[model samples]
Target: MSIAIVDARGWQNTLDLKTGEKIDAAGPVIKLVKDVLQRHPYPGDTDPGSNRWVSDTAFDLIDRYAPRFVFLTYAAQYFSGRYTPMSKETRARMISDVFLEAERFINRSGFAAIAVGTGDMTPLLGFIDVTRLDGLAVCTHWSTRYAGLYGPSPDDMKILEEHPHIEKIVSQEEVVRLFDGTPEQTLRLPEYLMLAREGYAFKTISDAMRIPVMIPSLNFNVPLHAPGHTVEAITGIRQILEEDLSEKNVALIAIEGVGLDEFLWPHRPCRNSTEWYYYEPGEAQYLTIVSGRHRFLDYPTGSGYKYFNGAEGAARSYPFSGHFKSIPEGAFASTFPGKSIAVGNKSMFMHMVTGADLSVECFARNLYNQGTMAVIHRADKL
Candidate 1:
């Protein structure tokens, strides 16, 4: 099996020295290709922007070098903000356009496998047809970040249990057992068991196990709390990804009871004040009230879905002070590629999942006052 890796550079940030400012750029993206080509040079000329040219180069490289695998990595900058500019739909469409261009190269080249480094490259996973690719992997230090959240607390194990989304929790010993197990036995365990059966679940067995289960399609009602109360919820999501769903390709969706403005305001105040004036919108603005809520929702699924909820687990929050919003009536099948869905609260959103093909919709209530939700879908379906 021959492999080829492609990496691009220069997409994440655009330099504007004239004003000493940086803006987002469209072309000449930066990625891992340079690093790989440095070690293993490709024959013939290289082309930029032409997906067909890139695809051909990948195949040519594989044919010439005959490597077991090839890795491709790239970066892109995404704009996030409140009102100063574009609407959410417009941003999403822009992203989708870039992704389609990249997919042409990825899907056409027949390689044994592809591995991607963490960065702005994750969203592309949702755009590609994984089934056509031999094997795929993403590299990130997500587990380490998750561990840090515990902050020298021994009760981390207990915290995992109360979390509705986390299905299993285990120690290092278990990891070894699963890795050493036979292929058949490992397959019977969690999806990660394909790598090792002894592996433990992070927050809940649902997070750990891929076994399909029956869950109601209707949405469930839950209460919202202060932002400080969100630690457990966020941590629970982290544990699920690091522990249970680490090896799977998944997407997340978060719904909020409060509008984008109130949910992300500093200090979790009901009303925006001058003290929280730092919440202004900008290209690099990292402090949007909505972004925070979105991060809490996407934290588990490795940022596959940013900002609003996708077709997968639609996590929504109902403010204790706000009324519940009705999801579009009628069941619509989730576009997620997997068999399970995880939710933050139950309500009309939950009902939507139940009515769809989703087998399970795990609900975690009061995890955060802001309504946020996530769903883990299979990659093949994408």
Candidate 2:
């Protein structure tokens, strides 16, 4: 019933500053996020680094925003680009180091923190015991929804016809075997099952350790595409949370942020450039405060995975491109049948939902616009 928008700017960027910048004496490094939120980045994006002076007083600002919990995010700056490409062992070590550093900052700040793990964290998180933290999110592979690709192929997507794309990928028998180390799942094609094994191995190990793992999925991204869709998606999310809370020890919801080339931007290049379902700013508040963890809560925007909720029907997304475009008046056209187009292009829903994006900017719609309508509970208006 409590929450605070914690920025996980990764670990490295915490101290690294722009030239001529002085690190504001030691403290939680969320001042930049605070300034961007409190003071409009109006007149274009304000270099938050310039406001390093605010880190010293971040706690004061947090006190003013007073909510329930906080998200201890790892900043990306040099870390993401620099290390995201390293081997699992290397990335895991870096992630673990970041975890230790993050804990120190969170303790110093006096806030109950939830761990948001993405990027090179899957197998690595399994290496640590996360139950000691307020919460931990075992983020699955970013490209898993593509049936295991940043963009999956028809063959890869076949099995998911019966399950949510992510569920199908992570829950694969092969993946499950890898999690427990067995040869039973060899029945499935090696290519399809191999990539998933990594994530499933991580999730399985993390869960085995009884770490408070938050399950993230493209499913929760449903709420932001349209008002009507948002209503239904929110209802589904609440239902999932309420059920888990009632049936389980702690309930968590994983809704991703929807944004322009958001942080999880193509961890590795794929066959085609594609983005997936994530929660935008205002969107995460409802789910986070209400249920559990949604990746990139700080990012603003998302797509949905309705199959996870059940009863997925025909729906439309923003339709940016790649879902079969119009000829545009004499543009060279293909003979792909119109009848088959509707049914054949069903995949477009996923693209539009995630790849397209929220029609409005979250900065204008959520951060700047204040009212009773908010995903996470806002503090008393100063």
Return the TM-score for each candidate structure.
0.22, 0.29
Q: Residue by residue across 25-142, what tens digits does model 1's lDDT show? A: 2321112222223332212111122222223434443443332222221111121111114455854554444345345534554322111111111111111111221222111111
Give residue 368's lDDT in candidate 1 (0 to 100): 17
Question: Candidate 2, residues 241-359: lDDT per residue as tens digits?
Answer: 23333332221211122121232212211111112232322222333323323322121122111012125344532122221222111100011111000000011121112111100
Off by over 4 Å in 2: 1-60, 66-68, 75-83, 87-93, 114-142, 146-382
* Per-model RMSD to reference: 23.7, 20.3
The top-ranked prediction according to lDDT is 2
lDDT of each: 0.23, 0.25
Root mean square deviation (Cα) for candidate 1: 23.7
Backbone clash count for every predicted candidate, in the order shown: 50, 32
RMSD of 2: 20.3
